[model samples]
Target chain A: MKYSMEDIARFAEGDMDGDERAEFEKVLQADIDLKSGLASYQNIHSSLKMKLSNDDKDKDFKQTLDEVSADYFKQKSKVIPITRYLAWTSAIAAVFVLFLIWSPWQKDLYRQYADTEMIAMVERGENSAALDMQQAANAFNKKDFSVAKATLENVIGAEPGNATARYYYAISLIETGDGAKARIFFSELYKGTSVFKYDAAFYTALSFIKEKNTKSAIVWLRKIPADAAKYDESRELLNKLK
Target chain B: MLKKLHEDHRYIEALLHNDKKVVQEIYAKFAGKIKRYIINNSGSESDAADILQEALIDIYQQARHKAFQLTCPFEPFLLLVCKRKWLNELKKKSVLQVTNIDDALLTIGEDVFADAELLEKQEAEAKHFEQMFEKLGERCKEIISESLKGDAQEMVAEKLGVTYGYLRKKKSECMAALIQLINKN
Candidate 1:
C-alpha cells in the first residue's frame, strides 16, 4: 500500500519477480484502490500495445477484409471459393469453373436447341414450279448446308411469307452461317402470326448462338410466350442461364 | 485458473498468423448469420459488413493482446457482440426499429459476455489513453509511446537520449499525469 507509482508501474509491467511479485500480489489482494490502479495501468499499456503493433497490420487486414467481403457479396447466393482467399482456391475453383462450363442450359438445353438437325426440309407445300422444294428438302436432309442454303433462298424469295418456307429458310440461313440474314427472317416470322412465331423466336435465339452472343440469345429466347410451342424449352434455357 | 482451449481457438491463431483461408472461412461460415440478423432487424448488408468488420477487429485485438484465448465456440460470442454492436450503431443512426431485435440465439455463458465486454472496455480505455497521452508535454508523449515499443527499455531510453534511471522515473511521472488527465475528464 505504501509503494510508489513506480512500484505499481513495475507490477503492471510484470517486471517484478519472485519475492517482489509475490509481495505485491499480497498487497494487491488487500488494497481495492491499489488493484484498481494496477488494472488501469495494465489496460492502458496493452491498449497502446495493440494500437502501435496492430496499426499497419489492421490496415492490411482491412484491405484484405474489404476484398473478401466484396467477394462474398458477389458470390452471395452461390457459396464460392473466395477469389482472394488464395492458396488452392482452385480446388473450389474447379467447382466454380465446372459451374460455368456445365450449366444445365449451356450443355443440355442450349445444345438441344442449337442442334440445327441438318434442316429436315427447306421447302413447304405445293410450290413445285416456284422453286425446287423437293430438291431443296433432299439437299437439306443430306446436311449439305450450302446446297440447302441456295435452294431455300430461291424458294423464300419466290414465295416470301410462306410460313413453312420462311421457317425452313431461316433454319438454312442459320445453318449456312448467315445469321445476319437469318435473324432478318426469324424476326419477321416472330413478329407476324405464324405457327412458327415461337419457333422463329427460338431460331432468332439460335442465330445469336451462331454469332457467339449467348447473352442476346438468352434475351431472344426469353421472348417466347408461355403459350408458344417453344415456351417450355425457352424457360428451361433461362433456368440454365440462372 | 487455467481455461480450456476451445477447438475454435484456430480462429485466434488464424488472425495472429494472418491465414487468409481461415479468415475467409470465417466470413463464409459466419457472415450470413450476422447479415440475416442485421437485415431482419432493420440494417442492410452494408451495415452488416461494417459491423462484422468492427467485431472481427475486436476479436483480433483480444486474440493478440495479453494472454487472451478463446474458451468457447467463437460463433455465438462473435455474433452476440456483433448483433449488440449493430443494434448500438442503429440506435446511433436513429433508424426505425421494425421487428423487436431478438437476443442472439446463441447460449452464451456469462464468461464470454464478460470477455467481450472487457474488450470493449479495453478499446475505450485505449481511446481515452491516446487522447490523454497527447495532453502531456511533447517529450513525455514521444517517450511514453516509444517506451511501450521495444522490450529493451534501456534501448528505448537510449533512443530517447535519456539515462536508464531517468526513463523509469519519467515513465511513472508521465503515466501518472495521463491517468490524472483521464480521471479529470
Candidate 2:
C-alpha cells in the first residue's frame, strides 16, 4: 500500500486519531522509505519554525558579526606589514622616539585621538564610485586630506546616504581645517543608527577640540557611553581637558 | 551515553548570546590560524574573514535550533568548519587550481568531524528549504508562517478568519507541499 504525502504529514503533525496513528506506526516501522520521508518532512517543519522565529535575532547577530569582522580583518592586515617595518626601523627607534615625544602633532589633542584608519573598502568591481572610494581611502590614509575631501565629496554626491564615506569625509574636512563643516557631517552621523554613531560623536568632540572649544568638547565627550567603542578614549581625553 | 561538555562550550555560548568580549577572544586566538590557512589556499584575508564569519553564524544557528554542544575544543572545530566553507566556496567559484590542505594537521576528533559535516548538510538543506518556501503560494505561506508563530491553532485560525480544523488541515498540506518542492529539486 502506497502512503500519500498527506498521510505522512498527518502522522508527522500528530493529527491522526489513535487508531489511525497506531496503523501508521505499524507501517512506519516496516517501511524505511516512509520513515525517511517523515523525518525529512519533520526536519523541514522544525527548521522553518526556527527560521521564522529567529530571523530578527539572526539579523542582529549578523550586524555584530560584520562589525567585528571588519575590525579584525583590518588589524590582521596591518600586523604583518607593521611588524616588518618595525624590524627595519628598530635601529632608528631612539631618534624616532625623541622626535615623537617632542612632535607638535603629538601635543595636539585633536590629532592624537583622531583615528584616521579608514576601514578599507573591499574593491567590488570597476565602478567609478567604488574606484572613488578606493582612491578616497588611499588619500585619507596617506594624510592627503585635500584629495580625500574632493574624492569623498564626489562619492557623497553620488551616494548621499553613504555613512562611511560621509564620516571619513568629515574627518578629512577636520584634517583640512574645516572643523565647522566637519561637525555638520559628524552631527548628522551621530544622529543616525550607523555603526559609526559613537565614532561620529567622538569625532565631533575632536572637532570641538580642534576649534579650541574645550567646553563643548567636554560636553560631547561625556555623551559617549561607557559601552561605546570610544568611551575609554573619550574619558582619557576628558581628563586631559579638565 | 551523555557526552561531557567541553570547557570550550563557553565559545558556543558566546556565539549564542553575542558576547562581544568572548567572541573577540575567539578571533584573537583562532582567527589568525584560519586566516593563514585560507591565504595559503589561494584565498585572500577578506575571503578568510567572510568564511570565518559565516562559519560562526552557522554554528550559532545550529546551537540555537539543534541544541548543538561542543564536546571538543572550539579551535579545531571552528577551523574545520571554516576550512570546509572555503573549499565549498572555491568549488562554487570553479577555481580548479585549488590546493587542498590535510585535516590531520588539526587535532580534530571523530565526533567534531561528524558535527561539522552535519552542520554543513543542515545549512544546505536550510538554504534549499528557504528557496522552496519562497515558491509556495501566498495562502500556504501565510498559513505556515502564522501557525509557526507559537499561537494556539484556534487563535491563529480566528486571526486568519479560518476555522481551527481547516487551519490544521491546510498547515499539513502546506508542509507536505513544501517537502515535495524540496524533493523535486
Candidate 3:
C-alpha cells in the first residue's frame, strides 16, 4: 500500500489521531519499504528543524567563532627573530666542548646512554604539548639545535610553569653551549616531582660536563636516585667524570 | 537514582546556547593543537580555521538534533572529528599525503572514533536530505521550508494565497515528492 504525503507529514508532525497513528504503526511493522520511506521523510522534517530555528543567532555565533579563531591563530603564528650568528657560534662551541670532554670510547658510552624520552612533535588531537614546545622538539630531533634552542626559549619565556618544556629547553641550551643556563634549568626540574625529574638530574650532570665543571657534574649525577630510570647510566657517567 | 552528567557537557551547552564566553574558552583551550595538526599535515592556517568552524557546526547540529551528551572529555572528541574532517578534505583536494597522517594527529579511543563515525553519518544524512530538498519546485520548497517551521498552517496558506486545505494537500504532495526523490537515490 502507498503511504500518502499526508500520512508521512501527519506522522512527522504528530498530527495523526491515536487510532490513525496506531494503525500506521501496525502497517509500519508489516511493510519495510513504506516504513523506510516514511523514515526518510521524517529525516528531512527533523533536519530542517535546526536550519529554521533563529537562523540569525547561529549565523552570528559562527561568524564570531570564525573571527575569534582566525585572530587567535594570527597572534600565535607571529614569528620571533633569531640571531643566526650567535646560534652558529654556540653550535661551534658546543661541538668543541664535547670533543675535548670525551675520548672515543667514552663518546660511544655517551652515545649508548644519552637517550632521553622520545620527543613527539606532531600532537594530532589533544595531548598537552604546546605549539612552540612541539616546534622545538621537531627542531631538536632534526639536529637543528639552534632552532630548537630559540623556539624552546620562546616557549619557556612565555610559559615558565611548563616543566616539560623547561626540561627540554635546558637540553636545547646545552646543545647550543649555554651550559650555565641549561644547568640551572635542569636544577629546577630535578627539584620537582615532574615526570622528567630524574632524567633532568642526569642531563644536568651532562651540562656541567659540557662546561668542563667536573665537580658540579659529579654532584648532579649523584642526585640520581637508585629507583630512577637513569640510575645505572648515571653511575657509569659518574665513574668516568670522577 | 539520577546519574550526574559529565562536566564537559558545558561544551555542548555552550554551543547550544551560543554562549560567547564558553565558545572563546573553547578556542583558547583546544584550537592550538588542531591548528598545529593541520599545518603539520600540509594544511594552511586558513584551512585549519575552516575545518574547525565546520566541525563545531557539526557538533552543534548533533547536540540539537540528537541531544548529544559528552560522556568523555571534549578534547578527544572534538580533535578526532576535526582531524578526520581535515583529512577527508585533503583527500578530496587530491593533496599528496607526504607524511604519516595517522601518527601526526593526536590519538583517541574507540569511543571517540565511534562518536566521529556517528557524526559523519549524521552529516551525510543531512546532506542527502538537503540536496533532495533543493530538487523540489520553488513553491513546494517555499511552502515546506516555511510551513514545517512551527508556523501556523492557516497563516502559511494565506501568505502563499492558497486555501488552508489546499496548503495542507500541497504540503503533503511536496513532502511525498521529496520522499520519492530520496528513495530514488
Candidate 4:
C-alpha cells in the first residue's frame, strides 16, 4: 500500500493519535521506501534543529552589533556636523558679512592711525635706559635671558643715574640665571634715592636666594621696607631658605 | 588603530571597556551570520530577531563580566557563544529531546561551527529549494510558504486565490514536491 500525502503530512504533524501511531509503525516496518521517507522527515527536523543550535552558537552577536552601531554612529556624526555647519552659516553669514561691509572707511582708517600713534607714543615716552628696563621685564616674563641681560646692560650704559632701571635690570639679571651681576645692580639701586629702594631691596634678597647664599638673602630681606608689597613674599622666601 | 588587549578570558571583557564604536562594530560583523543561522533552523524572521537579541544580550553579559576570551577573532567567539546559548534554550523547549549537548559543546572548535564550506552548501541547498518552489506554479509556492508559516488553512486558501479544499489538496501536493526537491539536494 502506498502512503498518501495526507498520511505523511498527518504523521509529520502528529495528527495520528496513539493507536494511529502504532498502526503507522506497522506500515513502516513492511516498506523500506516509506521508512526512508519518514527518516527524511526526521532528518529535516534534525537538520533544522542543528542549524538552529548552530545559529544560536555561532551568530557572533556582539560583532554584528558593533559593526552596525559603528556604521550608524559614523553616519550620524557625518550628517550632524555638516547639517549644523550649513544651518549655522546660512543663519549668520549674511548679517556678519553685512556688518563688516557697512563699517565706514574713515572709522577703519582712524582705528589704524590710532594703533600707529600708540606705538609711536610708547617709543618716544621712554629714554633708551627706560626702554632697556622694560625690554628686560618683558624678557623675564617670557623666560628669555641672554637678550634680557644685554638689554639691562644697555640701560646702565645710557643712564647710570636711573635707579628704577637699575633695580629692574638687577631683577632681570637674577631671573636670567646670573646672581653675581644682579647683586651689584641691586646694591647700587638700594643705596640711591627711594624710587627703586623697595624693589631693589626685594630683588637683592631674591638674587641671593638664586645664588643659594642664605646669609646675603637674609641681610637684604631685613633691609626691605616694612610697607613694601614684596616684604611678605620676601619673609616667606627667607623662612624657606632658613 | 589596532587595540592591544590583555591575554585572558577577557575578549568580551575588552568589549565592555570599548566605546559605542566597538559595540557597533561587533553588531555589524555578526548580525548576518546570526540571521542566516536562525532562518536555517526553521525559524521565521521574528524568531531570528528574538534569537539575535538574546544572543547579543548574552555576549554583553559575558563581555561585561570578563567571561569570554577570544583565542580567535571576536566574530567566531560570539557566534560560538550565541549558538551554544540558543541550543541550550532549544533544549529547554524540549522540541527534539535527543540532542547531543556534548557534541554541540565540542562543535565550538576553532573552525567548526560557521564553516564557510557548510554555509555555502546550505546556501546552494536553499537556492535549489527556492528554484524548485519557483518551478511549482506561483500560486502553489505562495500557498505552501504561507502554510509552512502556520497560517490557517482558510487564510492561506484565501490569500492564494483558492477554495479551502483545493488549498488543502494543493498544500499536500506542494509539500510532496518540496520534499522531492530536498531529496535531490
Interface RMSD for each predicted structure: 10.7, 6.6, 5.7, 17.8
TM-score of chain B of each: 0.79, 0.82, 0.88, 0.41
- True lDDT of residue A163, candidate 4: 43
Model 2 accuracy (lDDT, Cα): 0.78
- For model 3, how does the per-residue alpha-carbon lDDT over A96-211 read when each residue is reduced to its tens digit? 54564454544544343444432433322312335676677668766788898788778657655555577777877777778788878777777764446788888877776766
- Candidate 2 lDDT, B34-57, residue by residue in tens: 877887788887788888988998
Compute fnat per model.
0.34, 0.43, 0.38, 0.09
* lDDT, candidates in the order shown: 0.69, 0.78, 0.70, 0.52
lDDT string, candidate 4, A107-218, tens digits = 3321111110000012223445545655665564455666766776786686554344455556656655777877777777566533355667777666665555778768
> In candidate 3, residue B67 scores what lDDT?
64
- Checking candidate 3 for backbone clashes, the offending pairs are A124-B105, A124-B106, A125-B106
* Model 1 clashing residue pairs (backbone): none
DockQ of each: 0.16, 0.18, 0.21, 0.05
Candidate 2, A38-90: lDDT as tens digits: 88777887777656665656766766665456545643332222223445555
lDDT of 1 by residue, A31-118 (tens): 9989888887777778777776545566666554554564343222212222334346555655664565456455544335654322
Native-vs-model 4 lDDT? 0.52
lDDT of model 2, residue A124: 22
Best candidate, DockQ-wise?
A: 3
Q: So what's the TM-score on candidate 1?
A: 0.54
How well does candidate 3 score on lDDT at residue B174?
82
How well is each residue in B16-53 modelled by candidate 3, as lDDT tens digits? 89876677677766776787788888887667777888
